[model samples]
Target: MSFSAFRILAEALTGHGGWKPMWREPEPQARYDIVIIGGGGHGLATAYYLAKEHGLTNIAVVEKGWLGSGNIGRNTTIIRSNYMLPGNEPFYELSMRLWEGLEQDFNYNAMVSQRGVLNLCHSDAQRDAYVRRGNAMIMAGADAELLDTDGVRAMYPFLDFANARFPVKGGLLQRRGGTARHDAVAWGYARGADMRGVDILQNCEVTGFLIEDGQCNGVETTRGTIRAGKVASCAAGSSSRVLEKAGLRLPIESHVLQAFVSEGLKPVIDGVITFGAGHFYISQSDKGGLVFGGDIDGYNSYAQRGNLPVIEDVCEGGMALMPAIGRARLLRAWGGVMDMSMDGSPIIDRTPVNNLFINAGWCYGGFKATPASGWCYAHLLATGKPHPVAAQMRLDRFERGLAIDEKGAGPQPNLH
Candidate 1:
C-alpha cells in the first residue's frame, strides 16, 4: 500500500486501522536472478535499484538480523560531498544529489535535512588545506564556502574561540551537507524494494558461498541453499567474514566505531560541526539531542561495543572544541563495526570469484555513500562493468599500487 495524504485521511476516518507491515517477511526462494547478502542500507538499496532501475525484480536481500541493524543505524547520520579527491568526490556528489530527492522517490519521510556541515580549522595550515578542499569541492560540482574566524564565531558563539590551544582559525562549510534519519533510510529502501518484488529475507544468515568451477552461483544460508545467477556482498564489518567462507581473504580490517547522543536540551547546534584539532564531529537532531562521534577504536575486532579509552578521547575532543558540552549529560552511545580498507577508501568492484561482486571497505564514509554505492553496485551487477564515478574503486587498486588514500595516512586502518 502506497503512503499518501489520502491514505492517511482515509485511515483517520476509519479510526486509523488501515495500516499494514511496511514490507513482507518472506522465506528464502530456491533461486533468483540476484541474491544480495546483508540487509543493511546498501543491500536493500542494491535490491531496490536492481529492480527499479535495472528491471530485475527476481532478487533476494538476505539478512542475518532485522533491517537497520548494522552501520546504517549506528552512524552519526552525517552526509556531505566535501571530499577533495577525484577518486571519491564525484561518487559522493552523486549521492548528495540522490539524498536530495530520496524521500520523494521512495514515498517515505527519511528526514534528509541539509542544514549544512562545518569543518573547523585550528591552524593556518589547516585553513589553507580547507581552502584547497573547498576549491576542489567547487570543481566537483558540490557547494562549499570558506569561513574565517569571525564568520564562524558569528554563526556559533558557544565554541571556545579564546582557547590558545586549538584556536578556531576558520572553517570549511558545505551548505548542502547535513544529517538524515538513519533507520528510516533503511526501512524506506526495504519497503520500496519489497514493493518492486524483491524478497527481503530476514534471519537468513549466509553460511557460505555456492562456488563451482571458480564461479560463484549462489549462497548457503542458515535457512537453506539458494541458487542465483550472481551474488553480491555488502556485509560492512562482516565483509571479510562473508568472503572467507568462500576462501577469499580481503584487505579489510574490522574495527568498532562508536557514536553517542546526549540528553535532550534546548536547541544548540544549528548544524553539523567537526573539530579540526581532533576527530570529533557533532550535530543536533530534530528531537533536541546532540548526536556525535569520533575515531574508531584502535583495534581489530568484530564486537559492536567500544572501549572506554576511545570514549574518553572523544569526550576530550568535544570539550576542547566546546567547553559547554560538558554541562550536557551523556544519554547513551553505541558502536558499529567499520570495514577499514588499506587506503581508507571503499571498494565497489567484482571480486576474484566470477559472478560474485563485493562492496566493502567503506571506512568512515559508508553512511554518506549509501545511495550512489547502491546505484554503482547495481550498475556493475547488471552490466558487469564499473560505473564511471566508481571505476577507481576496484578491488585490485591496492595490488596495483594505486590506492586512494583520502586521509594521506598510508595503509593504516586505525588512522583512517
Candidate 2:
C-alpha cells in the first residue's frame, strides 16, 4: 500500500492521536497458561502470536509501565535483517518477513516503509565485512546489494561523499529493510492480543519469581501474585534485574542508547543510512523529522541517560555523511537502556528453571527483531524446544564456548 493509504488506515483504527490505552486492569487471575513480562513490542508480539498462531489465548502480558514505554518506544525504529552471523541471520530474516505482513495481520496501519537501509563502509576491512554480510543475506534469500562510491552518491546525493576523516567508499544495501511506526507496532500487537482474550496487565511490576522446587511457577508483582504455567521475559534493559530476582545471572550489561531528531523539515532522506566507520545512522520519519542514533555509552549504567560526546559524535558522523543535515537543528534527544549481551546476538532459550524462558539480550536491535523474536519465543514457550531459526541463541552457548560472535570480535559490549 502507499504510505498515505497506510497512514490513513492506521490513523483510522488507532485514532488520529496515535496509540492510546484501549484496556484497563483486569483482576490478577490465579493462573495463566503463559505470562510474559514487559509489555513492549516483543512481549506484545509474543502474546499476539501465542494467541493467533498457537491458539493459546489464556495469556497475560504483565508490564511494569504502560505499553511501549520501554526500548520499543525509544529505538529509532529501523528494521532490517542484514546480519552476518549464522545464529542471527535466520531469526532476523523471520522478523523482516513478519514486518512485511504486520499491517495485514493486525489490521492496524504500522506505516512500515521498506525504503531500504544502507550500511556504509569507510575502510577496506569494513568493505570486506559488508561483502560478507551481503553474501550471507543473499544466501538466506534476503535482498542485499553492494554499492560502490558512485552508486552511493547516486542513491544519496546529500552525503558529503568526500570527507578526509571518513571517506565514503561503498555500502551494503538491504532493499527489504527500512523503518516502521514504533508506537503503532506496540498498539497493533496489544489491540490484536487483547481482542483475542489475552489479558494485558499494565503498571504491574514483577518483583520476584515464584520458584517452587527449583521450578518457576509464577511471579510476585507489585500489584499482586499471578501464577502461570510458563513465563517468558522480554524485558530488554531490565532483563538482568528480572533474572537476578530468579537467581539467574546472564552475561548481559545494561547500557544506554541515545537517539536524536531534528526539527521537522521537508522530506529529504527517503531511506535509512548507517555509517559503519563512525557508528551512526539516520532516517527521515513520516512526520518529516530526521530520526538518527549512534553507539551506546561505553560504560554500564541503569540510568537511561547518555553523555554529550555520543551526541556530538553522531552529529559529526551525520555531517560527514549528509552535510545538509548540519544546518538542521536538532529538536529533541532521548535515551533508552539496552541489554548488551556478551555476544552481539539475542538469547531466546528455555531456562533451566523449568517453565521459565528468556528472549532478551537483543542489544540495540530488539525493536526491529520484535516480530520474529516473538514468533520464535512463542514456539519455544509452547513446545519447550528451540526453533531451528533461534537454536543458536541457546543459553548454554556461553558455557559451551559456541558463541555466535557476529562482529568477529570476542564477546564485548563496545565492539558491538
Identify the runs in model 1 with alpha carbons over 4 angstroms from their true place.
Answer: none
Candidate 1 per-residue lDDT over residues 360-380, each given as its tens digit: 999978999999999999999
User: What would the TM-scores of all predictions be?
Assistant: 0.99, 0.94
Residue pairs in steric clash, candidate 1?
none
The C-alpha RMSD of each candidate to the native structure, in angstroms, is: 0.9, 3.2
Residue 340, candidate 1: Cα error in Å is 0.4
Tens digits of per-residue lDDT, candidate 2, 313-370, equal 8988887787888889999999999899887888999888988998888889899999
How well does candidate 1 match the true structure in TM-score terms? Answer: 0.99
TM-score of 2: 0.94
User: Model 2, poorest ten-residue lDDT window?
Assistant: 16-25
